[model samples]
Target: MKLRRDGESVYVRPMKLDDAEALYEMRTRNQDFFQTYEPIRQKLVMTLEDYRDRISDDIQHWRDQTGFTFGVFLQETNEFVGRVSLSNIVYGAWKNCTIGYFMDQAHNGKGYTTEAVSLAVDFALTDGQLHRVQAAVMPWNQASVRVVEKVGFRFEGLSKWYLQINGNWEDHNIYAITQEDWNK
Candidate 1:
């Protein structure tokens, strides 16, 4: 699956096999910063080969229609700066998925994540033929909260101890946008 979506300053597409190195580098560089917001990983990348295998899984997931992972790139340099994903997809009676993303610390406060998410939500509700997309952000992550809000996701509620972040279970503010919400 070839998914390419562009924003004013950034573009998003799947990470290719050849991009494994870049992916590893970005993850390694941002591991410490990302840890504050993400679940603590035992290791960022055990080895480049293992990282490549994970990249392959991402591709396969996109192909299989189970999940979609996209690398955020700078339009000017085409530099890999971040990643976004629409995963936990569901169909039939309830067509929905959850959105996830992270940006390189260097690129923070640039609106890159907001634009990337907007484009991703477009794909989720339009191209992906899904009805709803949701995001769970830690209460402390105001940056991410703003990103989803900028993309028009409304606050749904709070999920107590929703996910374990950096080892301890953390409360999250749930936000969501349905197809109807997106159309508005």
Candidate 2:
């Protein structure tokens, strides 16, 4: 789905093989800025072939009902801004998943992250048929914390050493919005 904010248009669409180059460019440009908060990349250099394979895997994941990764893009220029994903999906008794996202540093503080996340949450709860969507952010990454908060995710406390970020075990603040929460 596409969302509009301010005067710019943004879209949340499934990742495609054709998007490899733009995705690579965005990631390479923001590598340094993202290292602190994101997981370390195993490879120092990524080829278009690698991205194609990755996108292919993403497609399989989507078909298998394991996860969905959406690319956020600028509708006017078709620039890849970032990605938001709903991973670790569980069904039956536990209908839930985790949401993760990152944006180009150049696009920070522009509400695009929040809009992308909001769209993901809606997809998860409605089309995806999930009960809860959760996100975890490093305490120091105030921008990400704000994005989740803006999307109505309530703070659910911290998880000590919850995730390995940039080779270090980092504490994370957990936030979530349930189907019931959305209904209200």
Candidate 3:
């Protein structure tokens, strides 16, 4: 869909096969930082070939209207900083999807993640024709909760053991914004 967003110092666009190496490095470098909030990676270090294959699969998913993943990069240097995704799409009567994102530990609290997510929500509601976009965050993950709240996702209470994160079933605080909410 060629979705892109340029912030004051960074930009967000779809992930490409050529981004395999940078993505790999970003994941590896942030392993410790992300481990607390993310599901446990099957591998400690993902090989470049494996990442390339994964990116290929992601491209196919994007083409098939199943999901979208975007890479966040520095505007001038093009340094890979993070990623955001809109997944679990369902059409028909639902027309909904879930959003998730992570940024480089060094880049936290800089507002880049908020900008990227805002752009994604706009694209999903307008261009992708989605009626709703949702996100869930671990109760302890204040940073993520702030991101969603900053983007105007309303609190929708908690889901017990909502997702398996860091190898354990964890409760999540669910939040969402509908197209109606966005239009207002």
Candidate that would win on lDDT? 1
Return the TM-score for candidate 2, rounded to 2 decimals: 0.93
What tens-digit string does per-residue lDDT give for candidate 2 at 60-126? 9889989989999877787889998999999999898999999999998888898888888888888
TM-score of model 1 (CA atoms): 0.96
Per-residue lDDT over 1-184 for candidate 1, one digit per residue giving the tens place of the 0 to 100 score:
2269988999998879988888888888887898898887786556778779988998998888889888899999999998899999998888889999999999999999999999888888888889999899998888999999999999999999999998999999999999999897
Q: Name the lDDT value of residue 118 in candidate 2.
A: 86
Stretches of candidate 2 above 4 Å error?
1-8
Per-candidate TM-score against the hidden true structure: 0.96, 0.93, 0.95
For every model shown, the clashing-pair count is 0, 0, 0
**Model 3: how far residue 9 lies from native, Å:** 3.1
Between candidates 2 and 3, name the one with more favorable lDDT. 3
Clashing pairs in model 3, backbone N/Cα/C closer than 3 A: none
Indicate the residue-level lDDT of 151 in model 2. Answer: 89
lDDT of all predictions: 0.89, 0.86, 0.89
Highest TM-score model number: 1
